[model samples]
Target: MAKILVVDDEAHIRELIRLYLVDEGFEVIEKANGEDALAYAENQSVDLAIIDIMMPKLDGWDLCKELRELDEMPILMVTSKGEAQDKIKGFKLGTDDYLVKPFDPVELVLRVKALLKRYRIDASSLIKLGSIMLDRRTYQVIYKDGNQVTIPMKEFELLYKLGSYTNQLFTRDHLIEQIWGMDYEGDERTVDVHIKRLRERFAEFESDFKIVTIRGLGYRLEVYRD
Candidate 1:
């Protein structure tokens, strides 16, 4: 059973989340504030974390920064503040996903599972294609000529999944399920956005492969050999 850490100031909210998480066969660890949550994280092997931003004693943002410094465990931010800036801040602090208040328990569970799946895939292997090398140990990509670029969490996972099986076509729905989770109710175009950003970022470096679209199917990483 995977262990999940839930941090919220409200007892009812914590219990609500716990009920659903436990029903899904996850071990639940609860904390009312970020202070306690941070302590628990340091001493425990938490697979994922759901944090409330408006808590007393070390808010979610601070705790997120602290935990991000320690490990790459997936972090999800839940709060009443649903502004774009808040979500962006959470992402910048290394949060894997953001859910606003009044969220559905089912959606929460889906996100949790999705994050765990993505994390497992990321930690499973190190991938190298031609001059580009993805080193999971350092969470970075290095080129044959020693040029290093640190990819964001989501982008890194996207690259890993695509590059893991070169020339294999992955449909958009499959990628969303594998990378974003089953309950991702967002637009499918989101995948295109991420892929475009990946291409743009890698364009600066020398890489032997490119992520290509399969015309109505999805995308694939095509490696061109010299």
Candidate 2:
């Protein structure tokens, strides 16, 4: 489901938009004004944002500008006023689409869906580490020597990230922040535990297939083919 940020002062408008988007299979996040919208955008991942122009603290143009600086997520500026200057300002601030108020709710939904479809991502479809193969879409981990492991959520993510980058080492502190979010509430030792479990799981294939520890630096996946 696509995550959408709806920034509007009117509670009725927020509810109206949320209802419409949710019906269309979107995950809607509602913010009453520009400041809270900005804060949400900085932390959460949003596929698209619908920003209203006449808002408290920071207006839509300024809010869009701030969001553009932080993330490349597509933005749609909505305003009651359909002035050319307002449209230009939003476009200059890097908004992907725009809608004027008193607009059709269906049109907004269509626009949101179209924007996401047009900007779809084709990220690396697969990640491989040693004899382990990770299928990005299916989220499957298979060993080359015939053993297979089906990982659950975070564990799968941790291994996939390590596999995706191959030989680049990442410290436990770094993995906690990167694989887990920066706001991860877990201890640093969580990385060590997961790595240990992963190593144990892979032991059926080869005792030497590497997730090497660099003493204090941390772990890297390295198995010499020679």
Candidate 3:
């Protein structure tokens, strides 16, 4: 059973989430504050985390960042704030998914399952998208025509990440943290530059997949289906 850490300031909210998750055969650990949640994660094994934005000690934003830095476990942010900017902030902080308040418990469970599945796919060293295959182990892009291209380390990683979760949106901040390390001091435009290079290098593979810029957001890989 996968262990889930649920951090919410409201007792009822935590209970509601726990009841539903436990029903799905998941092990749930409840924390009323981000500090306690972070402490638990550091000392224990957690497969995923459900965080609330408004908490007494160390809000969900910081907690999400801390957990992401700790490992690649998926994070789901549940908050009453439904504003677009707030959602963007959560994504930038590395939350894998988000849920607004008054959300159906069923939907929450579905999102949890989806995130787990997505992460499982991401764990693989090889990602096959349409006609192209990304070999993470060798940092090579193998085409259907038997042509292979090896790109820079950063470019390969960025492409691998996007292709791993095709059609999923990724904010620049999140990509920077995942590809460049949290301690990277370069500008966010570094992602833009690398993305441009990837586009140019794989321009002919448009039929297989394309990296799209979601204005004001970031980027997503779109794989064409036959």
The candidate that wins on lDDT is: 3
Q: What does candidate 3's lDDT look like per residue over 1-226, in tens digits?
A: 5788999999999999999999987889999999999999999978999999889989999999999999889999987854667898887777889998989999999999999888883332568878888888689988889898888999999999998798999999999999889999989999999999999988987887899999999999999963
lDDT of each: 0.87, 0.80, 0.89
**Which residue ranges in model 3 land beyond 4 Å of their true spot?**
121-226
TM match of model 2 to true structure: 0.55
**lDDT value, residue 88 of candidate 2:** 76
In candidate 2, stretches whose alpha carbon ends up further than 4 angstroms from where it belongs are 121-226
- Point out the higher-scoring one by lDDT: 1 or 3: 3
Q: Which candidate would rank higher by TM-score, 1 or 2?
A: 2
Task: State model 3's lDDT.
Answer: 0.89
Of 2 and 3, the candidate ranking higher by TM-score: 2
Q: Model 2, 25-110: lDDT tens per residue?
A: 67899999999999988888777889899998988888888888888788887878647688777777778988887889999998
Q: Which ten residues in a row have the lowest lDDT in candidate 2?
A: 121-130
